[model samples]
Target: MISTRLQDAINEQINKEFFSAYLYLSMGQYFESKFLRGIAHWFYVQYKEELKHAEKFISFLNEKGGRVILNGIPAPKVEWNGALDAFNEAYNHEKFITSSIEDIMKIAVEENDFSTQNLLNWFLDEQVEEEAQTLEIVKKLELVGEHGQALYMLDRELAQRQG
Candidate 1:
């Protein structure tokens, strides 16, 4: 957050990260209502991770001598009729997040902020992993289709996700 432009970008990202947490929490509730404990557990972990991400940005901004401006996060929708629907939503969300990281990268490059660019490089790689994981979950849900036993088994697999 060396420049005002970068500061604005960081603030916007912080807001997005908070929204991500809320979004995952919504998905957690959706999974619970569907009796998908493993999926719910996964979303819970995701929510925690997003919060951690937000704090990381917040701390970085402060350390860089930028003022942290907190913004209100919109409430996320809490309904997904099936695992497929929920995962499709997650996939789209990851796409949106990837774009956000790309935009930050662009800003870092445009401002010639080598330190910021170095930091953004991490996000660039992280977005790839994020999209891949979400897409994998979507594909798994698609393959599981209407098979309740398979879905449950998959949920159990997801429940083991840590950090």
Candidate 2:
């Protein structure tokens, strides 16, 4: 059985994951509005991935016999200055999520919750990939700054991303 504190933390993380999905979806819409279809598709994929992350947490919590009480997700920012801005925001959010997972890992350690700690390790590794990918995109966008052809090529490359 999960401790009450750990359970509450897991519930909070689940809600955050949902919010991440919402934020990515909103960004996807923003890209669509800009007519960057490939970028939009990428964000759509990210949005779906975030939902899967939430479901994974939910399943873990259920397996631990913990009650999950979902909280409301706040509105995500829909307007970005450009692709660079969107990717920067995403990279920042990934950093925030990494910190959150670390906080939960600390709690799990404190509570001697080995199972929860094990599960969080997966998230920790995921965040590393998440942050790396976003940052890499940010760098590429930076290089393509104010270059229309380059941006177009990058968009085409991004569109080829599968899953």
Candidate 3:
């Protein structure tokens, strides 16, 4: 059985995961509006992955006999100065997520909940990869510096993302 404090924290994280999905979806739409199809596709893939992450938490909660309570997802910002601006936001968002996972891990450790700690460990590792990928894109965008051809090339590269 899950402790009340842990259960509440997990439920909150579930809501956060859903909000992350929504944010990525909004970024996808923004890219589409700018006619950056490949970038849009990349954000769409991220959106789906976020949904899967939320489902993982939901399933874990159920398995632990905890209540699943979802909250409303606030609207995400739909505009950016350009591709660099958007990818920078993405990178920042990943950092925020990493911090959130760390907070949860702290809670699990304090409560001596090894099961929850094990589950969060996966997310902690994932957050590292997530931040790295987004930051790489951000760095490339910075180097390209508003160059139309370079941006197009980057878009094509991002299009290769699968699942």
Candidate 4:
């Protein structure tokens, strides 16, 4: 059985994942309002993917016979300064998530929960990709530096992203 502390943390992580989805969807709406359809579409896809991640954690908990006590998600920021700002926020959030995953791994180590640790291995690898993606976008945005046409082009490129 998973420790209550560990289960609670994991449950909280699940909520955060859902919150991420909500946040991205909100960003998508904002982008659409700005008439940046490509960016909006990219965020919409990202939102769906984040929801999938939340569900994955939920299912993993269920498979482990742990109760998923969902908690409330905090409100996400509504206003972004611009496309670059929004993506920078996303990149920062991804970093936070990466650290959280690392902390969970530390807890697993302390508990000697080999099974839990093994399961988290997948997340560790996934986090690498997550960080890479967000960082890439941030770098590209930085390079473009307030260039609308370039931003639009990047959006077009991102819109091609598929699961």
Candidate 1 on 2-21: residue-level lDDT in tens?
89999899899989999999
lDDT at 148, model 3: 75
Candidate numbers, best lDDT first, in rank order: 2, 3, 1, 4
Q: Rank the candidates by TM-score, best first.
A: 3, 2, 1, 4
Which is better, 1 or 3, measured by lDDT?
3
lDDT of 1: 0.87
**Model 3 lDDT-worst window of ten:** 140-149
Clashes of each: 0, 0, 0, 0
Candidate 1 Cα errors over 4 Å, as ranges: none
Estimate every model's Cα lDDT from 0 to 1: 0.87, 0.93, 0.93, 0.86
Candidate 3, TM-score vs. the true structure? 0.98
- Model 4 agreement with the true structure over 68-127: per-residue lDDT tens digits: 998888888889999889999988888888788778888889999888798788888887
Q: Report clash pairs, candidate 1.
A: none
lDDT of 2 by residue, 1-163 (tens): 9999999989999999999999999999998998899999989999999999999999999999999899999999989998999999999999999999999999999998999999999999999999999999999888768358988887888898778
Q: Which candidate, 2 or 4, has the higher lDDT?
A: 2
Compute each candidate's TM-score over C-alphas: 0.95, 0.97, 0.98, 0.94
- For model 3, residues 1-163, the per-residue Cα lDDT tens digits are 9999899988998998999999999999999998889999999999999999999999999999999998899999999998889899999998988888899889899999999999999999999999999999999888887567998899899999998
Q: Considering summed lDDT, which 10 consecutive residues are worst modelled in model 1?
A: 140-149
